[model samples]
Target: MADLTIRNLTITPLELVSVERFQGEKKRTGNVVSNVTGAITGFINATDFSAHHILPKGDSHDSRDVSFHLDPFRTVRTDVRSADPAGREVLRLTFRAGDRRYETDVPSPSRKSSVMKRIDGDDDVDDALDLTVVYVPTGAFLAIFSSAKLYAWMKQLDDAWPLPLLSIPGTHNSPTCHTALPSVRCQSVGVPEQLQNGVRFLDIRVSVNTDNDTLALVHSVFPVSLTSIKYFSDMVDDIYRFLDANPSETVLMSIKREGAGRGTDQHLSRYLKAGFVDKNADRWWTEPRIPTLGQARGRIIIVRRFGLDEEMARSCWDGRGWGIDGQHWPDNCEDGTCEGGHIRVQDFYDVTESQNIEKKIDYSRGQLERSAEREFHVIGPEHDHNPDPALLPIFVNFLSGSNFFNATCWPERIAAKVNPAIVEYLCIRHGEDGKGPNQLKVGAASTGIVVTDWVGANGDWDLIRCIVGWNARLQLP
Candidate 1:
């Protein structure tokens, strides 16, 4: 099979624009007054049609101004019968010239008529008609919200900042997982569920105006973790291959950890140094610090007798050790030679807990006491300079397991720090009027384009989608 490339698909891609609409307002008529005075007041104060200036002949109109010319497009209606009563039998076509009056009847005067069109070829009307008239008013034109235009404009912006494509879901080791669609000719990582589902989503809309002559690319990565050594190496190869295929456009990769015990900055540095990440790549710092509180919370007690991970580490490495699925802890007491090697499991639990335990048993009490007090203390602080401050509280909170502390909050905190550029706000769907606030979305002031918030799980697919959407919107060449 041929190798996939990310560049071929982005060349001269489709650009989208949006259009919006609103219901017209009803006009009011006074029932109190009768004839001339009321008619004069209503005619002069009418809001439907108002007077605007008509430039003199030979005067050039500004395209940016309200009086610019528009092509005459044909409009067809079934019948004019059930229309307004003001012009009951008449289509009351009103035209404005430079302060000239031309009124006439029509057996369907099906000729080209604009705000400048006047009744019959009268000399006075013709003289006034010589000047320019604005066909569509600025107010009415501004009121229209075109979804098509919005989509188109967004597509233009997306051309530069393309969104990532999503993939179908699958089951892996009893967990649900989703992946990113493969680039046409670039390598892609097989992100596991543990690494993928930690991203954030916001409900927002973006608009961009890219009529200017500039090509720009916007990109971001959704970080995923890899436990297996093979998967990690494979992911690195895919990223390097992706960068190789797209030398022209900019790309960003967002890296996130699945959870504690997954890995750390050292792991990422090793991957990047191994030439997995492109040297020319732009890196956006997110979730800069991760705490080790989960695995180290009760280390003070667990290690006071037997060191934590070291012991587990030794057990896992020792051929004859049978405890902890052969996993090794960080302490050396499992060999029975260290200073704390003589401490009993009962003493260990007593020292770790807030209160003293009075119950004693003969069967599995020793093992139970050891396991009870240790409770994954490997997740806590090891030294003075821990980067992730949030880790300690999370680990301490786990000891209580109260409903007050949020489980999702920790993941969110980690996710937030992953991408420093991500605007801090919740993207929410609109109720009632179906229009959402701008608070959740990011837009460029120069292009007025709304940033795309990949509407899926906070996983690799969503992250890649966000980047691809940005590429498409920005029209990055």
Candidate 2:
């Protein structure tokens, strides 16, 4: 466990767009995506390479299977040693792989003489030390082109449960009214179940206005705020069992999230300590960075309001970490910059005079609520027994956008199974290509996209506590 495990790097079709080209070869001029066949070679001259072996090659079919053996090809362990520099036992490792052909030297423990020089003969030390250096590769290659784990991981992500709903307390004067809304489900990219043992789940918040019929309905599918991470952690064992039973096959693990305007509501410091900081925390199968209940405990800021005027928008932009570049505009606004980006609004809604509708709103005088507060209820498979609670939020956030179409009622449709009539309605609406129940997609063969405006006025709006996605990437492996 101490040695570095060379996890296979995965490449998506999207990742290849920038790294290759085809003029008149098997890949036509129009096809930029390449299979990218290559080999990896690793070299280690310091230690004995005779004890190692190569991992078995995968089968021809089912590229997803990776049909290789799990037996670690190599292992390294720490051993005790005398005369070490740090007065601590030194480390020695035995590298083993398929056919004992893959072995290399690792950093050894400091000699006691070195340590004595520094400490002036302060303490005695052990005689010998050995460390475990494990290897999982098949060939001598280093620049591997395999993405089996990536796809496998994505598939697991697609199968988890959706985000839980936020129960907003109602006032005596204004009672809370509850309604079952549609739920969103995340899709897994595809990965074998066996490799999902240490994967982590996460939940994020998003927001949408009432006017956005499709988006609202989609966002409405699940409550964005106030989810319990305990539920997801509870199901980890079951997931592992499922994967263990199915060795070579890939499966998806879908999870839901609160969309549009909602945010997280967890004990920030405690959650972070458990998922992000604890050195001994059990996170073998967890996602890299866990979004804690602490960051978005109260108000889940999914979106913000910014004035349509370029100047006002600029002012709002300046305040955000993403608005540094003006040339890239919305999509490229990683730090509020306009460099190398495209606005999502361009794909779904029209950008009128610089107004990003998701942020600003103008309420019809009579329809305005006393406040921006409301209650929502989300329904899906229940999970409440896992150690990592931060995953629920992260899973929900990503699942909200998994579908390619606007008919985001997939979760509700599945839940409606408990209610015969609702199931019928869902089938009737989404059954065929634009021939299902929700007349929304029944007439076309396109990815359903739903969007509408709730607030009328356009201006710069800022959703409080926006954690840039880039920041999250830094902490990931």
Candidate 3:
């Protein structure tokens, strides 16, 4: 028996039959007991299994009869055993293929296991288990699944559902991953890593470096780091690579201008047009309108947070004319929709005079609730009124905050307080108790993009998981 490399090792409930001996009575269907401890046991050939079995010789021919061993791979049922009761359960699996029975164990999701390994021989086995299986808690499955898998699931939804209707997890100061300065360093991982880890929106702040005639990523007024750092072009190249590898997905990049220089906005705009946007026009969604998933595939939707001068706006590839101009995006507006229901935002980062953390949570929640409220559009004439549920505006919730005093209110600290609450709020809204199927649904009218900092810092992904899991409800039945 060779070590069998396993992939896609998901765990599902099993109903086992129980037998009792009393006064020499044979076991009957009514006497069977069910295991209620949620213990995982055994393996089944999920790919190829049927309920019908061929009738043996001298037996009444009834192909419809359900066979006791319906699964072809169940011949070695006796080999299956209950997992250990210690820290986390483990299920040992054994399956036969061409006179060889390979063996392996499904590791606990709580403990990180080697998802992929190089095997010595047998190309067929290698291909069979190429996709690694992970057993996560029912509600947090989306956190473990790859971004490519999540996009495939999104493709099943109605094409009319615009991007704003979805719950998108984003990063605040996305390209500040390399900064060593504590106050300025926002993310511990770079843009490419964040994108691959299911981040769909990126908060990019760019500045025009007059010295080198180049565009660079800036945090406030200074460069991203005290040392050599990434330029805006570098960030764009990384984005292009990720998009090329995963063509089914789209990215919403909120670009804002920062740093000091005369006509910096125009300079940055011209640089982006000639260097980046012009070359990748087809790869971008430049129209100032919300696009359906089908229309936005393999593209980057620009969300310009800076004003464009006349010259810059007239340029052939001006981003200000792209997707949504979040420039005059109001600060802390509780109204659900802004710009005549075209844009929605929740950026209440001013916590200077706040008395306690509760006030911050309350303010943030209020903003989120406002975004979640339903909006409608008139569909008929004035005499005969018909109001249909309209596609909600793009909701950009800034879950990051800071103040001169108490650096504790920094983006990372604020996320620590708000992320868990957001998860809990979603669980309550979806009526999830963590024991059954997670009915995680953030309808087109609810929570939109959640921008945070230091996500996955200290291994805390509950926020991202909750946001991603919300899309699980859209899966095809």
lDDT (Cα atoms) of all candidates against the true structure: 0.20, 0.20, 0.53
TM-score of each: 0.22, 0.20, 0.63
Q: Quick one: how many clashes does candidate 1 have?
A: 105
Worst 10 residues of 2 by lDDT: 460-469
User: Over all chains combined, what TM-score does candidate 1 have?
Assistant: 0.22
lDDT string for model 1 (1-477, tens) is: 111101111222211111111122233333434444545633432211212212122222211111221111111121112211222221222222234432221111211112223444556432342211111111111000111211112222222111111011111111111221111101122322212322111111111112321111111122121221123334334433533442222212222223223333334333332332234233211111221222211111011111123333344325322111111212312111222121121111111211211111111122221221211111223323323323211000000000113322222222222211111111111110121222223221011111121212211232222222222212221
Which portions of model 3 show Cα errors greater than 4 Å?
A: 1-159, 209-213, 311-320, 332-340, 353-356, 375-391, 430-445, 475-477
lDDT of 2: 0.20
Which stretches of candidate 2 lie above 4 Å from their native place?
Answer: 1-183, 188-230, 235-266, 272-279, 282-477
lDDT for model 1 comes to 0.20
TM-score of 3: 0.63
lDDT of 3 by residue, 270-336 (tens): 6666677788788888677778776887899888777665665665345336446677778754433
True-structure lDDT of candidate 3 = 0.53
How much is 213 displaced in model 1, in angstroms? Answer: 46
Error of 2 at 164 (Å): 30
